[model samples]
Target: MWDRIEPLMPADPVRGRRWADHRRTLGAIAWKYRTNSPWRDLPEELGSFQTAHKRLIRWAVDGTWEKIFAAVLAAADALDDIDWTVSVDSTVVRAHQHAAGALKRGPKAEASRLTTHSDAPAVG
Candidate 1:
């Protein structure tokens, strides 16, 4: 996977400072997402959390992520690994009654309802 992604990485233009190792940075990113942990809590051995986070953001902003995803999907399709047919079961699906243009409560009514509580206040 790393081999596949390495070629898709954007080249650093006018390189002043060398970028962090891609493998370690990618590992940090994967770990963060896999554990649903904060970037600041990323493991030290995987390199700086900021670097991983920055790389993710940069790739997303520059459309590199989308390109990589498309490339991967294309590769999978070429290898005949993708099942193009999609199946939908209508019996298991549901639609809310409100979908039929039901009237929605106004902001004032909603606000009052949220602020109004039945529980009595606690006494010291």
Candidate 2:
């Protein structure tokens, strides 16, 4: 898979410090999402989590990922390996009571806060 993607990555900038190995950085990124863990939790062999995070964001903004996706799809289509089938699933999960905007301590508590003091003595 790296063979297919490596070529799609952008060339390292000429002025800045050279980038970390693209393959290693990509592995770190994949590990992060696959485990649904924060970037700070990335394993050591994957290199610095910060580098992985930054690379992911940089690639996204420069459209490297989109280019990789398009190239992979074209390759698969050439091999007649793509099914091109689409599936949509609708699933619903109910929200918690508080998430539904339920009132705290019912309407009576809210009404008291809304009432004004009549005997405060109006300013002239």
Candidate 3:
């Protein structure tokens, strides 16, 4: 997988401070998402959490992530390892009647609002 993705990453600038190792940054990213944890919680051994987060955002904005995903999918397809079929059951998509724009108050409540206080019995 690394072999397939490494070529897609942006090359480090030749005349400035080198960027974090792509492989290490990627491991941090995978670990962060796999554990559903905050970026700050990333382990020190994996490299800086900020690096992983920044790389993720940068790649997303520049379309590098999309290129990597396409490369992976293409590889999987070539190996006959991907199933493109999609199935969704209609029963699983149900919504409540109120969600269909029903009245906020029912007919009984509406009628109650129309009643006049003068119609009530007098108290001694």
Top TM-score prediction, candidate number: 2
User: What lDDT does the true structure give each of the candidates?
Assistant: 0.81, 0.88, 0.88
Candidate 3 wrong stretches, greater than 4 Å = 85-124
List candidate 2 stretches off by more than 4 Å: 84-87, 93-124
Q: Candidates 2 and 3: which is better by lDDT?
A: 3
TM-scores for every candidate against the unseen true structure: 0.64, 0.70, 0.69
Per-residue alpha-carbon lDDT of candidate 1 for residues 13-78, written as tens digits (9 for 90 to 100): 675888888778778888998999999999889988889999989888999889889888988988
The CA-based lDDT of model 2 is what?
0.88
By TM-score: ranked, best first: 2, 3, 1
Candidate 3 residue-wise lDDT, 81-124, digit = tens: 99888897777676797797554576775765655679786443
Clash number for each model: 0, 0, 0
State the TM-score for model 1. 0.64
TM-score of 2: 0.70
